[model samples]
Target: MEIEVAIAGGHGKIGLLLGKLLVEQGHTVLGLIRNPDQEDDLHAIGVEPVLCDLEADDDVGEAVAGVDAVVFAAGAGAGSGVERKRTMDLGGAVKLIEAAREKGIGRYVIVSSMGAADPPAEGGDAFGEYLRAKAAADRALVESGLDYTIVRPGMLTDEPPTGRVEIGSRVERAEVPRADVAAVLAAVLVAPNTIGETFELISGETPIGDAVAAL
Candidate 1:
């Protein structure tokens, strides 16, 4: 089933890969980008680039308009301060959810961290701060009343696509390549049963298609 999908933060590392894969699969993709300069790259791959800052209140509603599903793939990268993390991670997700609700978007898929189910211990550093922000956003998504899939992934690596993965609810800490993560996102978009479910993803010997099916 071909669906029109909107990908927030689609200019970033994982987003770029997802845009390409979705396009290759014959799905209509709109790549929502905060950086205007990245628009050209996104357009080169058949993704309609819409300039909208999730932290800002403008152009976001129009960006998701007419789309069938939304993937919240945005994040605050390394070296950024905690405020940016909160705004971009948690606040940004909230804004998107609000906008999606207004737009009547039914399916929402969020990319979250593995240990986000539990709050980090005290004295948690920057990484912990990221996790907390994601956890908060995950909780918000659950309560949003939208069809949602929360993916808690372990360590994100830059390895090539392995075509294999491990997925289960309440799984312990594990690592998965970014390519595999993209595959999972694509699968969740098309899988009806994935809606309203949260799963932990990791790299394993199991085939990617089968792993998602088992989820």
Candidate 2:
């Protein structure tokens, strides 16, 4: 089943990899980017570029107007402070949901962090604030009545893909490669059983495809 998918924060590591995986799997991938410079990057990976800012786009529906599914992969960078975290992480996902409903797109996936569900007490730190934003976004998406899956991966790394993973409600604290994460996202997009589930991901012995199948 081929589908047209829109990826928010299309230039990010995980997002770009996910888009490329989708493209390789014969799915049309539209990457939403705010910078013109990022256009070439997406093109090189076979992902069509759609110019839009999750934070600044007045009508996000226009960006995802024709997509069959939407993946929220946008986030404030490591250097970002607390404000951008809310605007980009929390607010951006919320707006994406609205756009999904307006565009009549039912399939949605969110790339979140492992601790987002039960973040540490607000310690007045940027990381703490990020968790809060993610939790809120996940909550809203689940209650939005959309077919959504929240993938909470443990500490992400730039390591090469191990082609193995562990996926369930909770996984041991471990690092998973960005490539493995992308592979999981691609599978979840096509696997109907993954809908309405929020799972944690980590590196394990099970193959990526098998892990997703067990979802």
Candidate 3:
């Protein structure tokens, strides 16, 4: 089934890759990006770009209005402060959730991080805050009553995709390429069984389709 998918943080590495894949699969993809300069990049991959800052936009319903599904892939980068973690990581997700609900869009997928379930102590550190933010966002999505899937990936690398992965409710910590993560996200969107399932992702011997199907 070809569906329209709206991806928040659409210019991010994984988002771009996912958009390209979706478009190649004959799905209409709308990439929500904060910077207008990134529009061409999205267009280059056949993803229509919607300019809207997740942090500043109070009402993002317009961005997701007619999409069949929504994906929250935004984050506060490594150099960001603690407050940005709260606002961007957590708050941005909240905004997207609210918008999805208001638009009556049921399918939602969030790209979360490992260790978000049990984050380290909040010692005024940025990384700790980021994990806590992801945890809170995950909680919100679970309780939102939407058809949601939370994918928590281990350390991300920029290497080429391996097309294989290990997915489970809990998995040992390891690294996976961003391309593989994007492949997993695309698979999850089309797999109805993945709805309401949250899992950890990492490099493994299992093919991506089989891994997601087994989920």
Q: lDDT (0-100) at residue 70 of candidate 2?
A: 97
Q: Who wins the TM-score comparison?
A: 3
**CA lDDT of 161 in candidate 3?**
95
Compose the digit string of candidate 2's lDDT tens values, residues 1-215.
Answer: 99999999899999999999999999999998999999999999999999989898777998999888999988988899999989999999999999999999999999999998798777759999999999999999999999999999999999999989999898888899999999999999999989999999999999988999898
Clashes of each: 0, 0, 0
Cα deviation in Å at residue 4, candidate 2?
0.4
- What C-alpha lDDT does candidate 3 achieve relative to the native structure? 0.94
RMSD (CA, Å), each prediction: 1.3, 0.9, 0.8
Off by over 4 Å in 3: none
Instruction: TM-score winner between 2 and 3, please give it.
Output: 3
- Give the number of the best model, judged by lDDT: 3
After the best TM-score superposition of candidate 1, give how far the Cα of residue 118 lies from its true spot, in angstroms: 0.7
Q: Note the Cα lDDT for every prediction shown.
A: 0.89, 0.93, 0.94
What's each prediction's TM-score? Answer: 0.96, 0.98, 0.98
Report the poorest 10 consecutive residues by lDDT, candidate 3: 117-126
Task: Order the candidate numbers by TM-score, best to worst.
Answer: 3, 2, 1
lDDT by residue for model 1 (1-215), tens:
99999999899888989999999999999998878899899989899998888987643777899899999999888787778778998988988899899999988999998888887864477778888899999999999999999998889999998988888887757778898899989988998878889988889889877877776
